[model samples]
Target: MSSNAEIKISGFPEDDGYWFVKWIDEFRLPHLTTSSASVKVVLQKLGSVDFHNLNNLGSTDIRSILGQRKKDADVIIEIRCPVVMPGTLPLVFIGAIYQRGVYVGRLPTRRRTIALADGGQEGFELSLSQQITPPPGWPEGAPYSLLNRFEYSVIPNIMRSSRCLMINRGEDTFIIPRMTIFKTFYAPHTELAKAFCGGPWNDRLDEVICLDDFESGLKTQKITHPEQWNIILQVRVPDVFAPLLACFTLMSSQDRALL
Candidate 1:
């Protein structure tokens, strides 16, 4: 992706937290491209208190393989704060935003050994820093160095009980909040497919953007109601943090079905 590449991801929600995630080429000209693949994954949850391994609800055959998971694996995204889905335990499947194996951001992990090797314990942490090397195919002049310095965290809306990602760069932090409009706008009904991007509260509602019924042309609307209305999840963040934002958004898209 070019440094100036505008990243706009808009998708229909399968239900509450699960989204029929799709990568849009541009917000103005929202459309899916051949290079882009449809990813169907559930954004598990970031329980109000702790972290868990963000799990994939269905098949693990995620379409886009940025790189191999074996020795040939180019990127390994480790969920610094390991959390697992309710049922799956011990053996955790923590992977998100991987497109054909490319978008995998290596999570910090300890070097394991066949035999017991006593050493510093790998604390549960996901730090975006110099430790994260750029994937092999990254553009030469892109912000490869700056990418490492980015510290990502989840900003929880305790009152609303929803959570969004906050990627910090010095004093500046970009927020990626997913709003499930189906519940907020049409609480009693569940037939509308909507994707809204806005502030954390009602007073800040003026700061909204969207890829839903209100958007122009409505050319990009693919996943319709009955079939996909309930599962729509809209992840809107600044263009600069799109790549990293995808990592977490795909993991935990919304705090709750409503917020």
Candidate 2:
């Protein structure tokens, strides 16, 4: 039997701009205050105008305006989640830039912050140039007998990878084998949870299973009739990784559902 928890982010602004988002989750485990998280920002070219034309904003900080961009290219920004005091709440800062007297929507920042608790750790590196690979030190000859044929049929091949998210806390390494959207009843108490915790799924019982809404995103548009699917994650790690896992899950689902 494993523990279950929910991490939610609210009060995000309704305005459209470059978003500086942070999420914090406090755990009851010893020597652990919060989980390390990361943010992935993808800037796609919408029109003929290049991203370089929107420069000359200000200094490079989270509060600063978005910087320049290369012509005919998409920009991807990755920020390591900051560490705050145990009692501090999470925040999402919206930054807008001014170009030619007109306000630009959003931008990126390069400023870094010091962590109060355990300092800030480097974010998990997710490369867009390579495919999703399995975590290191995985058992070579183990069988993936966890998900049944019917379950495998529903999930895409890319989602079945051995690594979804990885978190490093000192000497302890946490790996999220995989995350997917399924019926609400298929997680926690079902065989899915057991399969994720046992056998080839990492063989660790100290796990954190999180069930969250599938429609969670940073966009302003509200879903007219949202689906009832829930994002299920069987993270073979301590409870501190719950919030970070949830954060990556939402981002990956919204940004790269096909990959």
Candidate 3:
């Protein structure tokens, strides 16, 4: 994280509430070394609201935040990100919604990846419409009230490659497998579980199935306390993704809500 590399957000709703948001990022030197790279920026919702009155609350909040008393909106999520790498690869903005530690639905952004270079700075904008449809696999006719939190990750496709398995059984003879073995890149839930149920708890859990069992325990009445089952979302950029320089400076903004 170079001092020159920073992320900032402005135009947040305050005096005149507006749902629109502008995010700016400045990446220099080490952050822009690679010709192309895949980096994910995650946006996690922290507040917990009552689901029973979700409709009224959502409408009221929208009107209040957007400074439009007459206009009504179901939901609004507009944000921008710096596009360090731009090509044919589309920007994948996915939202994973959860309710009490249970995976419920996913929301995919509507906008495509666009290159906007201003004085050596590059970025793109993401806008979700008011008539957003429920993600596939969501229960038909189910209300959005079931959702408690949102974890959205913006993944820009830059390093695209294909892998092939070549097996040699005889001299000068090789066989290529037609099928490609797919592996899960990353599991956010499992990572959360690991962080929450670490140390002595791991020993007590069964070996055959751990993550499923942990989720089941949380879903069932095994965890009596509601606070115990809370899922905390953390956004971390591993060293593999953003290699840091020894003396580079890093800038970050603290969330006032957390304070």
| Index of the highest-lDDT prediction | 2
Q: Which should have the higher TM-score, number 2 or number 3? A: 3
Reference-based lDDT, residue 112, model 2: 38
On residues 30-131, what C-alpha lDDT tens digit does candidate 3 reach at each position?
A: 235553332222233322342233344554443343232223234443333334221101111223323322233333223333333354232221222111
Per residue, candidate 1 scores C-alpha lDDT tens digits across 12-101 of 122223211121111111214422112222322222111123333222323222112344344433211221111111111223232222
Query: Candidate 1: lDDT of 63?
Result: 21
Q: Give the worst 10-residue stretch by lDDT in candidate 3.
A: 175-184
In order, what lDDT does every prediction score? 0.25, 0.30, 0.26
> Which ranges of candidate 3 are over 4 A from the true structure?
1-95, 122-239, 242-259
Query: Candidate 2 on 13-54: residue-level lDDT in tens?
Result: 223332332212222222234332222111222221323433
TM-score sort, best first: 3, 1, 2
How many clashes show up in model 2? 3
Local lDDT at 172 for model 1:
45
Residue runs of model 1 more than 4 Å from their true location after superposition: 1-116, 120-126, 129-131, 135-137, 145-259
